[model samples]
Target: MLEASLKTQMQSYMERISQPIEITANLDSGAKSQELRELLQEIAAMSDRITLVEGSDDAQRKPSFTIARTGTDISVTFAGIPMGHEFTSLVLALLQVGGHPIKLDEAVIEQIRNLDGDYNFETYFSLSCQNCPDVVQALNVMSIINPRIRHVAIDGALYQSEVDERQIMSVPTIYLNGEKFGQGRSSVEEILAQLDSGAGARKAEALNAKEPFDVLIVGGGPAGAAAAVYAARKGIRTGVVAERFGGQVLDTMAIENFISVKETEGPRFAAALEEHVKAYDVDIMNVQRATKLVTGGNLVEVQLESGATLKGKTVILATGARWREINVPGEQEYRNAGVAYCPHCDGPLFKGKRVAVIGGGNSGVEAAIDLAGVVAHVTLIEFGDELRADAVLQRKLRSLPNVDIIVSAQTTEIHGDGKKVNGLSYTDRKSGESRKVELEGVFIQIGLVPNTEWLKDTVSLTRYGEIEVDAKGQTSIPGVFAAGDVTTVPYKQIIIACGDGAKAALGAFDHLIRSSVDMPAEAETATA
Candidate 1:
């Protein structure tokens, strides 16, 4: 059932249709189809300028819908039920069909027009992904403006088999003609470049074919950027390799705790970080993943996925930690649809809605406490018999009236209505009975895995696989420094990582001074 408040919100977003917008729904009476059909009908009912036509469903054809201007055959299609995060996509399609101009740069439009052959962009996204909407909108607009371009936004949770076949491990993954075009957040300009250059096949790009850097940072997060800036200040040739420039900050939403700045968002903060680092001559290689690391030589070697090697007199590792996934059914597909990972990134999107947090650890409890203030209600589920969080955290979570804690519970499956998560099923350990909770979203905060697998062979790692580092951020290997969540840091926070990065950069400089400096004058004269 749709709430009146939600209906009002939808109505406000529904711009008035000028030209006649025709929606032909070729749907069966199945549950998913009927649900989508009803929602579409409701949307059409809001605008008298819109027309809906119900066509007989054919077994060979999927439950699809086409939105087109009344007179033209140029149109877009939704092959399946558009729900969850994709609901917005459908609305945008309707608006575009109703004569809304495609707002894109002229250069970008030229690039799109230049793309030869049929370019089918199938972007898999979860409703909860903060960056997904932008990517989806870009593809949708491209499809509307260019006849050669056709885009489809697929709900990964709804099609598990397809996700498996395609090897989609993450959300906001774009497939260009069945090949992975890009993963994570991508700009329209970046996407255009990838399309124009045929970079969908994961082509290897060369990095640092010439002189070796005095210092090379392996990540692009706050830690790595800090190191780069510090190293560059010393007037040494510095380089940086990053899978993405933002790192974990991209997934983080609010920044109230970041000292000095009263408030800021993730993307903005990341851009600032980049700006600060770029002030110096830092050779930044964005979107490059490190596959291996070799130490002990005069120059350390960092191998990338592209087969290009980066050499450095000193190497600083700052690859941040990644969230651990539950790997439960519906978890992958419904990502952003109702299954979310970062509370800070996706919590505000679900304001005044009910949600659940899986895992009884400190992270889970913390997420529940954080979301309780923004969401209508919170349900915290744990597989253990009791919460593993500190007593203070437990107290804080208990102090919240809208939060519910469920221990000794095993999260069985994530259930959704083909689009967004409607609820989830959990089995009570004591009773051996299955139970279900109705909610709009599920947040996963089990733990984190350090991004140091490539450095394991080259550096001394702790039992947990984190890069072992000293107080000054020096690693076990000389001329090698490490920082951030990937190292043996006491706490993983933005400020702490920044401080750690600064320390590591200083330590690398110190190593250069101590190990490479000319011997004292007396010793040099004695040797001569």
Candidate 2:
């Protein structure tokens, strides 16, 4: 049930409804069902247009409900209590079903409505999952836009039998018509790209047709957002093309280190960054991955995986970084089938189960400490001779009864039954003895790897694949700069990334001005 303050907020939101909406509950007499019923009743009391109806108990899932416009098939369903990270999904569903307009691009809305095939999407999500809400909200909106599309957001924790039967070890695992669709966070455009085969081709063509930009950003993280805003404010044409707006930040959980902001979640911070950038004249193209960089032409050309080439006078690379994975056997095979990278996102799935955390640094130790509360046992394996975590963290980790730490141990292989992970093999550094931990999940908490693979031959990179940059964030290639985790900046923090991005933008602007001034008078006249 919602708190008093939350109820007041919901009332204010419900006042926007101009059409009647109905909440139909298909619940049993269980405790969870009763709790859901009380929550629904509280919701129905907020607005006159909203009404609750007791529906038949023939539904397959108990404690489930559907929100639909009166006398219309357009609706969205939740098989469990939509709280925690999904609280926004519940509120959005209510508002959208009550005739409140959705905040999406018009072209996207039309595309959703024009989809021809029948889509039955069922997404398995955990309440603690930060990425599940995006997929849930997107699918829910699509269902409302197109009556032919129906989506049900199921809480994986509540429906343990279903999760176990499907061998689901990851959050936000989506199923389309009873078959696996995707296994991670997805956006409306991404879902549409999968459902509609030609969507990618059409998007590539459109991107290829756009005019060149003064400053084109290759990422959409904090760094990219800051660069776009600064460049756009300078009265120049700016654009951002990203694989997924927010980059690694989207996968991040808690962000307490960001200055000024007391505390915030990754998704919320990323949303604010996007909103701030959108307030300017920056043109953001999401879900576009840059495959190649060409600095030969007058305008730098960034080739995308979709076969589209984006041209810009100066390019700012903020491609960011991703979680470093252990390339041992069965790691990739059982990924999401008990091999997870984010302990915060996937820890709940391994409740009362044994798991292993690879690494002895702060992230690994912290993850072990967190998992100790939810999982049955946690074994922290370190490749070094000792833990490199902070003293306080090590103290806290040592205090946990269900946690065990092993230093000087290298993870060799992850063992699975072809469907899910069952254990892992490791070797002791001192004794050179092989050992195995019988666990259900393996959480990799190593450092990050720069997303500079595409710039391998094009730019000067360190041995570690990070872009070599100067104080001004300029790369080896003239008029091309890099920032954030992709560059050789010391720390890879969000605030640091933002500062580096602003510096890179300024560096690009300075390069542009100097290059223009260095041109011959006749050349400048002709160019004008």
| Residue range 1-528, candidate 2, lDDT tens digits | 789899898889989888899999988989999999999999999888999998886898998999999998989999999999999999999999889899999999999999998999999999888999999999999999999999999998899899999988999999999999998999999999988898999999999999998889999999999998888766677899999998888888889988889999999999999999999889999999999999887899999999999999899999999999989999899999999998877888899899999998899998999899999999999999999999999999999999888999989999998889999999999999999999999999999999998888898999999999999999999999999999899988999999999999888877877775243333223210
The estimated TM-scores of all candidates read: 0.63, 0.97
lDDT score, candidate 2, position 31 = 94
TM-score of 1: 0.63
RMSD of 1: 10.0
lDDT of 2 at 349: 87
Off by over 4 Å in 1: 1-114, 117-129, 133-184, 187-205, 327-339, 343-355, 361-363, 366-378, 383-403, 410-441, 516-528
lDDT of 1 by residue, 115-143 (tens): 78788888877555656665787787777
lDDT of 1 at 435: 94
List clashing residue pairs in candidate 2.
Answer: none
